[model samples]
Target: MAEREYTAVVYSTTSGRVIYDLDLADDPEWSARINDVGGGRITVPLQGGAGTTRVREWCVPLRYSLGVLLGDHVCQAGPIVPYAPATDKRLLTVGFKGFWELLNRRVLHNKAWNPASAKITDPSADIAITDSLPNIARAIVDHGTTWQNRPGSFLPLDLPAVLPGTGTNVRNYPGYETASVGQRLQEITQVDSGPDVLFQPYLTTSGGFRYIRHRMLIGNPLLVQLGGALKFDYRSSLVALSIAGDGSNQANTAFVKGSGNEAGTLFGYATDTTLIDAGWPALDMVDASHTSASVQSTLDGWARADVALYGTQPEQWQAVVRADAAPPVGSYSPGHYADYSVKNHHWLPNGLYNYRILGVSRSSGTPRGCVDHQLQAVRTG
Candidate 1:
């Protein structure tokens, strides 16, 4: 069976309590509706740390957890808007980001006196493992009790050995951009940690925070054969395909230049390539606020990864497929959804099809709740 009802649960993240629960309605096109859902991405918005908006004449503050419920599962979207008023003339255009989106809104952990560390030291020498993304990710996420679901790292960071007590004082600021925690984390996984550690921050269907490291964009595939896939009477289906290439997913030559506060050589370069291309070149510079030799090595590793992704040959891509199915309305199912534990229809790498509900939105219309939410997936292999 499919679900036809929805409830937007509002609760204080500050206090962690249910304040109100608003259900899906088909009254008019001016209230609320849910649609455009993805596995880890959705569109739901809030404001300030607190405030109020008019819902059916009643004022609802912009604080607390704004969770969406459909069928049998509930997922936390984010905090409510803090300061929007009920009488604002313009339509309050608020599109909250997935948990990962919100998480990526802050800078990574780095300070003037001390920056995040990517250096590898003997297990006995350095206990903090400071700059490690896995280590840093935990510290960054373990802050609030409001929406911090499960905090852990799944990165198989089988980092190789490094000399102990080499640059005991050398450090990297990793730069500070009022950017997102996700963005800051990007700086490391893409440039600092190099190929040794690459990760993608994601939110589980259960609302837990996790890092998809080794999987890259390729998770276990989902089979959609006649009797192999979950049974769903889908109403509509869409498959979008595209291909691209840098003509260089792999290179025999790679280089990285860096900059920072420490005073060393004015010019330096790093190469981790082993191929004999006569001169297959892949180059990049890192202003990620690094100047140490360790940083140079890290940058070199990044160059190698880039070559791997854009050097060797044309990158073969896949198409994205989306569907819409809801709880059985009678004899037809419009979309398909299930628990994270079950084989839900969400996105996957290598064509494992599944779906996750990001959140929903509300808009004014002839019938307030008349929006079609779609379930999107990738073309299964």
Candidate 2:
């Protein structure tokens, strides 16, 4: 692997000011995901110098964010959480979670017109909102982060005031209050063709760090499908590849129960006839506790999504590849499609397969920069 320089910069999360740049970083590893929070870690030599003391003092959890930069671009960054010294006491390792983890700290509150003093546990008199999914997600985030609704949850950031080309599947959010924002956001993604609510961090032109909520609708044009020009081949770019097909979680029929108790519970079910016709046995998966869904279509949507995501046997691909390969490590995000071709596999067909990128984990090589990237993907076609 070729040698490259990687710097770890700790900055204030509140003011976005550079705090300190670590002198040395060892064994840096990071992973990012569109569905949930991503994280990374690095180890630094603790020589008991003034610099080491400064690192110990300023790298407190939540107050500061650690950014791993390759040249000018910030490949991964997050708020520092763990700072532990080695057993030999010669080196200190630090870890951080993605900025999106902040959402876990606050809960969705029905404070549509309530005063700032309103308590989260207090019953809200505001009626449930009926709007598009993207708009609903934006409202949930804004209510949790804006100062006018709640002072402590204020985050000075700019998000999409209006999501472009959002889904028309209007949903209801009646039980949104009291649930953690992170949990609710994830639950909303269980619907058929739901959008991915991602909290992304970026470096400003002036070198400041900031975050934004990006709503990525399913099957949107921004979700690029890479092949031909940008492909992953076993001979080049890919160092290793493995495929696994699991039927343990497979369900030919999916049942989604929503918003009720006992006999009054609302229910919706979907079955994959293709799988059934393919001789797959009757397998059932029940998804429950969608108390926010009041409409029948919303329940049906969840069932369809469950069936699509878990109804059939799932093929997962794991690949170890060069970070600087054709498309590069930082070029594609989750939800994008890429062609993966392997010529001579002992048990599989020798051809190109289209896969959806799910998550990515990259680690620094012996020379220090990120050189190895491992991808987790699912067969989409």
Candidate 3:
């Protein structure tokens, strides 16, 4: 097989303009996550020629972004950040975090301006939004991107389109809260009746380089079966497998405390009686924060979701597969379903198990040419 070459380019964050092209990146590796910010790394020699110096100068942390490409397709992209130089004093490495970091940097409320004082200040009341889960998420992002003293080139991102009519989720951000946009999104989407939030990147057909699209998807985005031709079969594509089971942090009961003081405080509990009836002691967990939860059902929603996730012995499966294997890299992303099977075990029998893909990681220039897939069992009990 021929050597794989990866190229990179830097773009201005505020104006989305091309800043520089990184033609000499070494050891480029990237990772993507479903629920959190993903990142990548590229290395350059410190003593290289004029171009190397240019890469160092143009890579302004937080102001610029790096987009890695395989031919014309962008494999990974993110805002550039500083990293400690490589130990040998020969190479310099810079890190780039995913576009999701933009959400992390902003808050729930748009900046407010006072006419008489001629100044901008935080809103007087908390941001309260009640809508379908997807719509509510989009609202948070829309207002979160707006600020009072933005640069001239700072353009507010357009609200993303979301699937219609999926029940409702209530979120409240008190005036004092200033909660992170990313954290707020995660909190709303990870609960019962919530959809999965995905920040996907795409290249523009015209002149726009790489752009990110915020999406809310319900359930698994793609489903793979045990006998499907495109799968991570243990007999073929699976290079190595590591299975881990842990119940140390497991809980069968959850007491969710909502906003209020003293006797007026809202409290809700959800318990998985099946676990207790099966001889496992009733382990309890308390989540004391929904400061904006006005109704008891809001706290109950969180309680049920928490109990479902933490109520069982969670198992994590990490599998490494050849990059060119069926359902290759880029073909499958986080939130897809994978049907895995292991043949003949002494204690664990030969059977098929379903898991939801949580993350994907790959490193170019490695001898293995492998993609690491992280998965967790889809709890449906």
lDDT of 3 at 340: 67
Q: Lowest-lDDT window of 10 residues in candidate 1?
A: 212-221
TM-score of 3: 0.82
Identify the runs in model 1 with alpha carbons over 4 angstroms from their true place. 1-7, 15-18, 23-62, 68-70, 73-76, 80-92, 101-133, 143-183, 191-255, 261-294, 312-381
lDDT of 2 at 368: 32
For all predicted structures, in order, the TM-scores are 0.42, 0.84, 0.82
lDDT of 1 by residue, 39-119 (tens): 111222334343224332222333333555433333224444433423544223232322343344434333211222232
List the candidate numbers ranked by lDDT, top first.
3, 2, 1
In terms of TM-score, which candidate is strongest? 2
Residues 1-381 of candidate 2: C-alpha lDDT, one tens digit per residue: 223366677777665566676765454777766666888998877777786788778769988878776655566677788889889767888888876677777666654535554544445623255556666666666666764444566443456756565455654343335577676667666677666655545555353544322232332212344554457887677666767777778787888887778899888888888877878678888887676566788888888888887764577666666666577766766666667788887656788866666666665542232243334444454
Give me candidate 1's TM-score against the actual structure.
0.42
Query: What is the per-residue lDDT of model 3 for residues 1-381, given as tens digits with 9 covering 90 to 100?
Result: 234466677776665555666645364788777766888888765666875577667768987887766555565666787766777666678889877787787655544422244422345435767777767777666666654544331431345566466645566676456678787887776566666666655445326554432233333223222334346667567676767788877999998887789898888788888878888887999887665567777778889988988887687777777767677666666777776666754434567667777877766633355767788763333
The alpha-carbon deviation from the true structure for residue 98 of candidate 1, after best TM-score superposition, in angstroms, is 2.8
Most accurate candidate by lDDT: 3
Q: Better model by TM-score, 1 or 2?
A: 2
